[model samples]
Target: MVQRRYSGRMDERFEIFLACAPGLETTLVGEAKAAGFGPLRPDAGGVAFDGGWPDVWRANLVLRGAARVLARIGGFPAVHLAQLDKRARKFPWGEVLRPDQGVRVEAISRKSRIYHGGAARERVERAISETLGAPVSDDGVRLLVRIEENLVSFSVDTSGEPLHRRGHKEEVGKAPMRETLAAMFLRECGYTGEEPVIDPMCGSGTFVLEAAEIAMGLLPGRTRRFDFERLASFDAAAWEAMKRGAARRETGLLFRGYDRDAGAVRMAGANAQRAGVDGTAVFACQPVSALERPEGEPGLVIVNPPWGARIGKPGPLHALHRSLGDVLKERFRGWRVGLVTPEAGLARATGLPFLPPGPPVAHGSLKIRLYRTNPL
Candidate 1:
């Protein structure tokens, strides 16, 4: 197969935003910087960069920390509905949006005279529908119109689905970790896919799978299709060539995942198979007490143990946390640890020498933090 370099530039440049969990913007910055995306500006919930369509495609293809990618197309200041409608009609809609493909327009107003978001959305939707002859559908290219202080801006969701949905993991356990979050967590622990990784309570094997994929040089978006493909600016042949240009490499290390439930182990194995990283990852049905260090290398042991809010009685949970700490302290010498929990008390029960916790990240309704330790 011929590996061609893709240089598919859009007609216009864009301000690309890579969205992530609020606390993870810096960690995302690290990953993006390592991937050669530079001059990064980190915002509250994401990072922004200047690039063309090729950068958007590459960001969707490789940036594991981004929840979704948004392209700032264009916008204007409109004080009222009539002005908004008139301005929206004059803006060029045919540049990036396809008339044949459908579109979905959504609007939000904050401290703007156009207090009614529904009315604003209808106005823009009507303009696109009438101007480009594009049909309005519930499931279509998402056009987000932000009306802030009477200035309305348009952004297109280039990633149709969240990047966390890597198109694998057909089966997930209760409180399963998302691939994007798991990737960020792994990076925060300084894994870099260069060393072995162990997830003791590896529900559905998110960390191990992500580790294996990274080590094997697999692209996250390889198995999935992005929403950017639907836009008029998309180039299918170029995208196909870009996907083909990636080559997988061999790795000597093995990513290990253990779960107490036999069903979870089976599910994880199947998920790894689907992700094409099964060859480099190993999964087993085992308790934390049964976890022993693997030979040949001292790597990182990261776990998202079940928290008190998630399940079971507190006493047993505390003991479980204590036992996890004891096992790591007594056995896994020289291996760093990254533990995620909802409470500091549970982390303290582990008795490991932990550094300060990172900012609390929202995982569902409960907030969680990652507590790290130097090699013990």
Candidate 2:
């Protein structure tokens, strides 16, 4: 198959933001820098870097824990609705949206004259349809217009559904972590596919499966469609090439997950199979105490133990953390450990020396923090 080449040159980069879980911006930025995409600047919800459309697509395909990819199309001064309408009409809508396809407009206004978001959306929608011949839809082309002070900035949601919905997880547990967030947390935990990855209290195999996928070189978006596919300038041929050029293979990286519940083990296996990594993940119905060190050496051991908010009573959770800490300290040496917990006290229960915590990630309504110990 002929692979498609993105129109822009390799050096042509756009301002790309790596959206991460709250408090995870610096960590995600560090991951991007470690992966050599740097000169990263920390932003409100993510890290901002400059890259081309290819980088954008690659970020979508490879980034494990981003919420959404947004493109800063342009910004301008707009003190009134007329200026907003005229600017919206003149802005290159044709370059972003197809005339035949529909789009949905959403907006937020701060201390600006155009205070009505609905009015802004309607004006932008009208400009796209009347001036650019694009059809209008309710849910497509999520146009986010921000009016702060007298400046109006427009951004488009390049990632259609959040990257968390990798499209393979059909079944979700009561309090399932988003695949994107899980991946980011794993990265924050220092997972580099060079070490052993273990999710002891695997709820549904999210961490293990994501690790397997990364080790295998499978593009997370390989089986998924992006909103860019519906854009006017979307290059179907280039996308096909990128897709066909993807490398999928097995590796020696040992990924293991153990859940005390049998049903969770089954679900993890099923999710792995769905994600095309069933053969790679080692799933067990045993408890965390049974988790063994990878054959060769100690690497990165990461876990998302149960959070009390999702599982109800806190008694079992504390016991679970204590046991997990004991097991790690007793069995695994020379391995870096990472724990995700809703309560700092729960993490403290593990009796592990932890670094200062990062910002909390939104796991449902409860905020979860990632705690890491030194590289043992």
Candidate 3:
């Protein structure tokens, strides 16, 4: 695994944006910085950093919180459809796109003279086909076109699938928390992989497995493929070396998860095994009331419980929250808690002293928030 040094030249560098759930921008920024990403700039929905192609690969391969990584290829002012088509044709698609591979162009316009999204998309698609001789398909590499105030920018979705699909965790429970979101929430709770984590309502053991992997220094995208692999600029040898050179450490602490459903426990255990964290992650089937603190120092107890958005009714959920709060207070003293839900009232039902929560994050159609409590 030879370390190929990249001369950070201006021509070789480009702007890369790591998209995340809206409210978790700060947490994602911290994770990105820790992963040696950049001098970062945090925005509404993501964090921006400057790097070359290798940085793009590292981001997709190692970032635990980003939903997708987008590379800003080029931008110019296009007031009308003809100008957009001309500029798009002149853009260097061959540098990033292969002739045999297909592409899907998506366009969005806001406060711009060329305001028709469909027309913009059509022009971009035609330009790509005419200029690069590439076929267009729905499942091809995604190219995004943003025409805002007559300025058009082109970006390619480097991450084909969402980062949450880590090429493992085949089984999922109802309304399961995405692995990306789980990782960000863990970071928001001040988790640094030095303490044990418990997800009492662990649906498919996302939090527990992610914690174990972090503690062991496993790469999130180790088993996954990216859209960059299809690009013309992809370097197979360098990428193989990067993957082979990922550092893996050992931890004595065990991350634990509990679910009332026997099937969920089995699924979680299987997912952990596939993630190569089975030795450090433990999953069991048991009700929350039966949860007892493991023998060790106090750690974090995080749960993404049913929020009544798609699951149970609000009344029973209130009781469930109350019971969870009671159990934690009575038995799990000195342990911190991080609870995620959509309703403030439901979070209040827990009766745990929570600090001011961050902004609401868009998850599907619903907005969720994280409520953190000091050590009890």
Candidate 4:
């Protein structure tokens, strides 16, 4: 499903799908429900809902846990490529894209007779190009066509760049967590911006920054320009008004981050500044053992320590985990703890009372599991 991030006097209703990290569907659905959405059902890495263009715009702008927002264009039975072509030709491509704007088509076929994906794409491209006089290309205004079990569906991408690039992080450290992943991890930990949040191993300050932004009620897409602006019905005035509304809301302080590496600490500071959350977030350069719990009542402490794959050998890293757990138990008994790691054995060595670990979230080849502990 391609993201539909447009606004205007067109259709008031659409089928919107939210893409999320695996094992986080329940979390995302909960978020949507809390945000006054749903009757949502669980699906692979996403939650589907019915809404209009306003909801679509709002989702991309405010959703902290979604990877992307796809709008369903149309779907139909396609026994062969010709059927796909006919259905695609009848679609309202002209409403979304201008004749001067170039379009790209991508197709995938499975469990059906229409196996030639390249040929299917070509047919779709020709249909739109010849019928609507819209030019076709390998780039720009991507229209993703998915064919499975002899069924064909079409959608236009409304999010030009992936939602992860929130235009905030100018400098990122090695193995830095993406902003979306950071937000999702924080949500999984039941963060609601009321208490002080700490990230002891905050490489590049992603987790800390996301927490700060959430506390402030800042729209994640405010600082960045979206591809939706280029669509046919984009209401610049409304979008600007929405941006102003978000900016007018003052952001609060409920977040801090610490990294033992001075270089990472400095990078985190720079990223925070770029993200406009520097004033609300505090970054400290100190070892995990020396890092003190936030000076308040019981809050939340989330960490992303360097596993053996990114920075060090398993022996030293295991010792680090043990030291972290020891410090948490000794100094911060009332605080909840959430840990993100690639190794379950090492996570267990932390000695935290985490339940069954979460399913793996794909970060390239490295699948990570999130483990959490109760606030004792």
Best by lDDT: 3
What local lDDT does model 2 show for residue 253?
Answer: 73
Regions more than 4 Å wrong, model 3: 1-11
Q: lDDT by residue for model 1 over 1-376, one digit each (tens)?
A: 1111223346456688999987899999998998888689999999988777878898999988899999888788888999999988877788778898889988899999999999999999999999999999999899999999988888899999889999998899988888998899888888888899999999899989999999999999998998889887888998888889899999999999998999999999999999999979889999999999989779999998888787767889899999999999999999999998889999999999999998988777988899999999
What would the TM-scores of all predictions be? 0.96, 0.91, 0.95, 0.92
| lDDT of candidate 4 over 1-376, digit per residue (tens) | 3223334455567678888878778888988888776678779988988876667777888888888877776667788877778777776776676787788888888888999899999998898899988787766677888888887877666777788889888788888888888888888888887777889888889889888888877778888866566666567887777677765346444578888789888988998888877878889898887977656678889888888898789998888999888898888889999999999978988888886877789876789988988795
Better of 2 and 3 by lDDT: 3
What is the RMSD, in Å, between candidate 3 and the native fold over all Cα?
Answer: 4.2
The residue-by-residue lDDT of candidate 2 on 264-299, one tens digit each, is 888888888899888788788997778777788777
lDDT of each: 0.89, 0.79, 0.91, 0.80
In model 2, the clashing pairs are 3-241, 4-238, 4-241, 13-51, 13-52, 14-51, 23-359, 65-180, 103-137
Tens digits of per-residue lDDT for model 3, 143-240: 99998988888889999999999988899999989999999988999998999999999989999998999899999999999999998878899999
Clashes of each: 0, 9, 1, 1
Model 4: ten consecutive residues of lowest lDDT: 1-10
The superposed Cα distance between candidate 3 and the true structure at residue 215, in angstroms, equals: 0.7
Clashing residue pairs found in predicted model 4: 3-158
- Give the clashing pairs for model 1: none
Which is better, 1 or 3, measured by lDDT?
Answer: 3
